[model samples]
Target: MQNIIEVKDLRKEFKSHSSRSGLKGAFRDLLTRNYKVIPAVNDISFTVTKGEMVGYIGENGAGKSTSIKMLTGILNPTSGSVIVNGMNPHKEREKFVRTIGVVFGQRSNLWWDIAVQESFRLLKKVYNVPDDVYKDHMNHVIESLDIAPLLDKPVRKLSLGQRMRCELAAALLHNPPLLFLDEPTIGLDVLVKLKIREFLKEMNKKYETTVLLTTHDLTDIEALCERVVMLDEGKIIYDGKLAKLRSNWGEGKQIEFQFADIHVKKETLDPLLADLDAAWTPGNQKNVWIANVRNDEHIISEVIGRVVASNKITDLKVHEISIEDIIRNIYEEGIING
Candidate 1:
């Protein structure tokens, strides 16, 4: 495998202006200008091999967008270097633009009044794609995305899901080897999201396109990317296999149990469930108790045994740690301990 994108010690900073608060504060801020240098992206380095799908994930304002902007040549790095497709993206903007495709979820790249197919045609002309090649590519994308019926529909008339499909097709029509997708599946229903994920997977397999995906959706990362690069506060915190992240941060298990009565305060039950890290709360306004047991495999059995020995139990259930919880734990506590 060859490297398609290489970033070395990349750093980006932004000047922050003092924010106006009340009317008095606003007037004062206008009179006296103040600004601070905020590091949007600290020293971070990574490489993407040809045909690899890499997930870039982080919380809001965590430098995910800044990194993507630098990669796409929309912004220059304050220091370090970025090479995409054997060219420095900032120095070779024209040549690099032809080899890469970008899709921003919050914005539209298609004309509002034109039909979806019209947008594709315009893109073909803009990219100078050959007639035959454009037609074949357009047809393949439309069919693969199941947007055949949507071709004749105007961009403004289509639903969000439909519009998103067309946007993806528009970006991919040029057959760029590297694609940068920012929240491609944002704000869609479960079924539509699944459809988009499947489409992306098939596209990668068919075209061998290298993808750099930035999204807050963990499902997207789990379904599409084997390697994940996590960022926080403009710094690269974790870069490794997704499975390893799960194994390390996903060790804790959650157990929920309902008891017949709240005879014992949750505090009292804590002593009996000392072997397991646990928290007990009132299940509802009722007398039943709900206990959240953590890090104990025999949590249910132990709770059952303890309740049966002392009181009575009605219902019990246990669930493994979820990916959301794992990521949350990582963000709250550093991954070194989480």
Candidate 2:
């Protein structure tokens, strides 16, 4: 497996100035300059192999977007190197961009007044894609995304979901082998989101396109990526399989057990529950009690035994921590440091 993207000690810094408060401060600012250097990406390094989909995730102000910008040649790194498709992205920006596609959910790359199909045609010219290749990609994407009916409508006239579908097709018109998707499904309905996810999955499988996806929606990551790179405060904290990240950092499973006796009292059950170390909550049902327990097998068994010994268990459920909760915990704990 060849690495489609390679980043080594990548760093990006920005200089921002503090605005003068009042007339006196403004006069002082005019006399001199005040600036502060902020490191948006702090010596991060990672790799993505061909045919691999990686989820890049972090809280706001984290360096996920900055890293993607450097990798896609939109921004030059203040230090270190970024290689995509065997080319230095910042050095050979035009050539590097030719080998990859990018879609930022907050912005549109499509021509506002032009029809969706025309925007794709213009992109084909921009990328110098051959007629046959362009046609094939267009046909595949249009059909896969079910955007044929939207082709004739002006980009600005389409709804967000409709326009997003067009934006995705436009990005792929050149059939770039690598894709940078930053919140691609953001602000879309559940149905539309599912459609986009399905199309992306099919495209990756059929074309072997390597994708780097950054999204706040954990469901998208769970569906699209097996590997994830977690960042915090401009540093990579975890870079490995999503499952392992969850298994390692994941808090634990929550167990909910329902008892046969609907009128069971907490006072009576206090003796049986006193031995377990788990937190207890009264379930919505009168006889049910929920226990938040660790992921460990022995601890879970002990908790379950205590619950069962107190009363006849009718229904039970064990739920692992969701990816959303996992990421939230990571942020709240300040687990990643530069």
Candidate 3:
């Protein structure tokens, strides 16, 4: 497979003026000149092949937006290189952008005063899409996104979810080969998100479009992407299969047991709990105990056995670490390697 997006040693920087905290310092600083260089994207390199959906994820101020801007030719990198579809995004701006579509979650790409279908028609004219091709893409987007009813309504009058559906449709009207979605599912209801995810999956499957999705929502990553590229402090940290990341950095399992007796003696359970090396905590109920067991299956089994033997377990439930928790651990621990 050919790579559609290639970035090598990509870097971006900005100059900041030094500012003083207090009134006196602020007045004195006006007489002097000083500047600091901040690196927003530091030596990051990765590639996305045709027809692959990859997640580019990070916490706030982690250079995710900066990298995306550079990739989309909105902002030029301070140094190094970026190439998409055999052309330099910044140098060949007009031609490069035609091959890709971008959607920012908080921004509106549609004309607010126009009806939804009018917006689509405007995009059709802007992209010079043929009559047959426009109809084909429009039909697919409307059916896939369930936005047929929204077409006649004004964009400003639509709800957030409805507007989002229309925005996605407008972006795809050109039938671009590459899609760049930044937080597309942010602030959407679960049902709307599910619809968008399904549409994206079908778009990739049926049209062979390459996608680069940037989102804080791990559920999006888990459901839509096979590979992920993680950035931290303006540098590339981990880029690999999403499953491998879960297996390597996944959090410990959780086991909750409900006992018959509410007044379980602390001392009586100390010795039994001491053998399990797990982080135990009190559950919501008085007769409940929750333990964060190790990732190892054997240890989890042994810990459960010990709990069951000591107390009459009325109910039990076990769960693996959630993707959100795993991502939290990654940000907290600053784990750079998988």
Candidate 4:
């Protein structure tokens, strides 16, 4: 496979000012300024080859967006290098951007007052796409995204889901070789997310477009990516195949504990399985809690025994631990730092 992205020792830092409380501190600030250098991306490095969909995920304030900004030539790193499609992202920005498509979830690239079709036309001209090529790709994307009805509507008039479909169409107008998606399905409904995921899969298959996706939603990664790069506090903690991560988690069983009290604290349940290879997190419902416990008869019984003794358990259900559960555990516990 050809390498589309090459990042080596990529680091980005920002200067933060220190503030103080009272009049004494205000007077201190008049004479000398205090600055703290914070590293947003601290000596992290990774690469993506052509046609690969890789997920870059982490918690909030984990530098996922910061890294994306640097990769897209929007921000210059304090040190190190970034090369995309054989061009420096920062130094060769004008040329480099031509080979890549970017879709930020909260931001729109389309002109708000113009019709979606007009934005597509403008993009075609901006990227210098041939007329025939533009028409063919435009028809293909509009049909694939089911956005034909939205073509005549202004961008601001479209709903979040409708605008998202248009946003996707806009990004692929020029059919760039590489795509960067940041939370592409962030605030959309489940059906819309499914539609976007299917479209991404088809586009990847149809065009062999390399994608670097950064999302908090693990389901997106589970559905679209075979490999993932996990980050924490601007550092690369785990980088490898998602299947391998699940395999190493062993045969664990997920037990959902439903209680009468919605105000139950996790700290009360964690200590029961402290000595075992287990993790607990809040379930979809407030009164329900889920735990991934090792698949040992004795271990499972010990956990249930301890918990049942303390609380009035309304219901208990056991099932196979899912990939989402393992990834969520990593989010809370940092279990796969190696």
Q: What would the TM-scores of all predictions be?
A: 0.87, 0.85, 0.90, 0.87
Candidate 1 — what's its lDDT? 0.84
The per-prediction tally of clashing pairs is 0, 0, 0, 0
Cα lDDT of model 4 by residue, 229-261, tens digit: 988889998899988888776468888999999
| CA lDDT scores, all candidates in order | 0.84, 0.87, 0.89, 0.89
lDDT of 1 by residue, 1-338 (tens): 89999999999999989777889888889789678999999989999999999999899999999999999899999999999999989889988999988888998889999888888888888889999998888788888889999889899999888888888988999999999999988898888889888988988999899999998888998999998998999988888888888888776555555667656577767777777666665655465666665566577677667866876667666667777778887888876422
lDDT of 3 by residue, 1-338 (tens): 89999999999999999887789878878898568999999999899999999999988999999999999999998999999988899999999988998899999889999899988888888889999988877897899899999999999999999988888888888989999999998899999999999999999999899999999998999999999999999988889998888888664788888889998755666677686767666778888877777778889888888889878989999988777777778888888867
Q: Candidate 2: lDDT of 117?
A: 80
lDDT for model 3? 0.89
Give residue 89's error in model 3 in angstroms. 1.5
Q: Which stretches of candidate 2 lie over 4 Å from their true place?
A: 19-26, 256-275, 280-290, 296-317, 336-338
CA shift of 31, model 4, Å: 3.0
Best by TM-score: 3
Better of 2 and 4 by TM-score: 4
TM-score of 3: 0.90
* Lowest summed lDDT window (length 10), candidate 2: 329-338
lDDT of 2 at 189: 100
Residue 248 lDDT, candidate 1, scale 0-100:
82
